[model samples]
Target: MADEQIEVLVVGAGQAGIAMSEHLTAAGVEHLVLERDRVAERWRSWRWDSLVANGPAWHDRFPGMEFTVDPDAFASKEQVADYLAAYAQKFDAPIRTGIEVHSVRKNDGRPGFHVETSTGTIDARYLVSATGAFQKPIIPPVVPADAGLHQIHSSGYHNPQQLPDGNVLIVGAGSSGVQIADELRRSGREVYLAVGPHDRPPRSYRGRDFCWWLGVLGKWDMAAPPVGAEHVTIAVSGAHGGHTVDFRALAADGITLLGRAEGVDGDVMRFADDLRTNIAAGDANYLSMLDEADEYIARNGLDLPEEPDARILGADPACMTDPVRELDLSAAGITSIVWATGFANDYDWLQVDAFDENGKPRHQRGVSSEPGVYFLGLPWLSRRGSSFIWGVWHDAKYLADQIAIQRSYQAYDAPALAAH
Candidate 1:
């Protein structure tokens, strides 16, 4: 016999899982949420100490709660974790922390799921995989393993003091990479930042934050990335009360900006010669966003003031002049390397035929093709904001509705079977 049984089971205890629990409870669906660690463990433990929420507090939170900080201010990592915990507590979510799920498979000869956990086994009529998107850190093997340098992924990096005393090379010019590079440089360490394809958006424009403009322009509800393009991380920062991320300013401040890291030959790290090209792409994205916002304002006849300064934050002439193509780590006195190349989905335990060849979940707005299986908290799951806190809440509500509808159908079928 299974150690536990429920009508619905949700795996994970972070924002997505807890949000699922809240919606399930409201729908009167008997469900339990299993968490491997404490509530919002990713926010609480996995992130660096200096990290903050990318969105402003007012916009990033679930609808039911408000942050103690000012609406326009960004929330710290600790504050975000505490907020999620409080949200779960306020609703008395049925969360079982410390229960690690080892595997999940369809139950043969039965219309349900068999879940194997660290504590015991569980059987449920429905399963919602809410483990989130940032599961596994993807660190490329660009640098040799025998380079004899201390290397850590962005997820494992905590603070400047955690690294050895010397110059640092941070690959991947995403938000994490730029932020860490800036931090290290400020701490009196020579930092090398490898630039990559990324969107550069102003933190605020026209007397409002960029997130506010997105919401107003209905950009957050954007269903998908542009055709023939995948989503790229935006180069913005919430550090020091929030500010626009200008690569030119960063370069001027002593952070050596290099092209994308290519490979390593002996002790020399090779970089591409497309630094200017990458910077221009970011600038294009930045200007395009501002143009969209301005068009929206003009069409609506809004009384917002025009901010011309937003358009001027473009490519750095100095960066375009000459970019470093290669660096000898040993000669540069670089003692540490931080790989901020992003994450990959780790659903090896999900023994179901619900994924594409790329190992990505196959779902239509969280509803999987396999019966009684669902996915939540993935980027662009239903819309562009599907992975955000506010977005996850809405997605969870939809999944709960699906579960309730399925239960109703099951109830009808049970009665007819009994009569037969």
Candidate 2:
């Protein structure tokens, strides 16, 4: 709130930013967090009605804090939003919501960074880009131009029952797409799941969450799941819902699985001629990820599933979602198309030159390549699964230590570095 005298400036007050801010608070460091909307507003408003976190409640805990909510009761999007708010309140973290930061640039000669926002300009020694990857929606370019084909991106999808009475084709086999497909099928709307590389699982793997296996192993840790450098998890998207309709179980329940959509011509959603191949590829990817998870478990000292939990439930090695149709636009009575495809990480609004060949900031951790700039909360920053709230806790601590070490104390104010 002071005039150009803030000690630390944090951008994007989401989970990563909050985690970083909490450390600053414990250190008695004065700082400010800028967010475009209310904290966790996107999570609160964007999720679909039937959405429930895939992982157990224990998975959502913050650093230095336990998620005391029901461990077995998976939280809906709304509940998770409230929990984040409560976490912020618990630490009395200083955040200014509804304030969008436009750009971040280094101050010419100062030992600090500069940021321009809707409110005003801020100068601080460190900047953390906690703006996550799920902020923007990605829609396929070749979708049908039919005025009748109703489609919505998963981000805006609130409730499936709100859609009309007709056959629904949920594209993409990611958690959102598959989950919506199952929900629509159960509600009696003929559902078609246009499958892609999906992460499918057994119905009930040995009475424990299949995810428990990964956690038991170190796959979710630094240097785990990634095939390249340290495994940095992009985003922990969703859990394999054991409570509701499992995607694997839905295959037997008569929900149709189709090949990837070739393109939609009017109401006739055309699919690639080779539906079986697409299904096989998707299934194979899921199996491989499982194998990688299992390999990590065996390497670690975790106890193995004695009775073979993975195979307890039968799997349809041949399961696939099929038949893309070229629908008649006006005749089909469809209004829109929901692109449950996924999200892309965008940083055009961020006025900096810190991105690498992948358009991502090159950082040792959250500390950016630039002198006084840093980033946090981008999935898989340093190791596998580091993007999740559960993972961010560890990363935030490491990054805070990085920031603290970078801030060397001096006897007097040198007009270069400010210590409070």
Candidate 3:
């Protein structure tokens, strides 16, 4: 027999899971939210000390909840965690912290799920996997383990003081990589950032924040990127009171820009000769966004202020002029390497066959192909902003409605089954 029984079980206590809990409560669903650690543990522990919410407070918060800070301000990691905790408290969410979910499998003999956790077993009629998309940090094995260098994934990095007193090599120029690189460079460390495919949206466009423009233009509703396009990480940052991530600006500020880190040979790091190409790609994305915003303003006849300077493209950075194809790490005094490569969804504990060949959950929005199973808090799960805080709230509401529908159907079917 299971240790506990629940109508619904949410397997996370972060923003996604908490958001799910809020909706489940409103829908009159008897659900319990399980968290391995404190609520928003990732924000509290995994993220760097200087990290801030990428989006402004007004746009990043859940519905009916206002952040204590200014709407235009970006909340710090600690603040975000506190906000989530307070939000959960306000709703009186049924969340069990420090209760880790071990494994989840369909109940063959029963029409439900058997969830094994650190506490015990929980048989739940419905399961919502709200553990989030970034479950495991993915650090590629490009460098040998015996390289004798202190290597850490982005999630493990806290601040410059945590590393050895030497230069830093940050691989993968996504938001985290660039932000950390910038922070290190500003801290008097020689920072080398490996450039990769990324989108460079301006911090603000024509007196409006980039997120505001996206909302007004309905870009957030985009279901998916164009077909045949490579996955490009967003290169925006809200650190240091927010600013546009200009590679040229970063380069001019003494941070060295290199092509993608391809591999490592004995004490040497090889890089692709595509620094300029990558920079150009990011620039193209930046200009494209501005162009679309401009056209939208023109077509709609809105009185939004125009900033012609936003369209001006700057010259290439000096570092890009003579890109380094290889770097002798030892000679360069590079004592640490921060790999901001990305993350992968770890669903090993999910025994349900709800994933595709690519290991992605097969779902229509949050509803899975397997009955009573759902996924939440994944990028582009239902829309472009599906993983954002506000987006997750909406998605959670939909899932709650679907769960309600399932419960109603079960109620209608139970009596018929009893008759037989």
Misplaced by over 4 Å in model 2 are 144-146, 201-204, 222-248, 273-275, 278-335, 409-420
lDDT of each: 0.89, 0.66, 0.91
Model 3 misplaced stretches (Cα beyond 4 Å): 413-420
- The pairs that clash in candidate 3 are none
Model 1 clash pairs are: none
Q: Which is superior by lDDT, 1 or 3?
A: 3
In model 3, the number of clashes is: 0
- Give per-model TM-scores: 0.97, 0.82, 0.97
Give one digit per residue, the lDDT tens place, for model 2 in 97-129: 999888776677566667778878777767777
lDDT of 1 by residue, 247-296 (tens): 88888898888988999998999999988888889989888889988988
**Looking at model 1, how many pairs of residues clash?**
0
lDDT of 3: 0.91
lDDT (Cα, tens digit) per residue for candidate 3, span 1-420: 999999999999998999999998887889999999999999999999999999999999999698999999999999999999999999899999998888999998889999999989999999999989889999899988789889999999999999999999999888899999999999999999999888899999888899998998888999997675436888999998899999888888989899999998898899999999988988998999899899999998989888998878777777799899999999999999999999999999898979999988999998998898999998887899997999999899899999998888888844455554
lDDT of 1: 0.89
Go through the candidates in order and give the C-alpha RMSD of each one to the true structure.
1.8, 5.1, 1.9
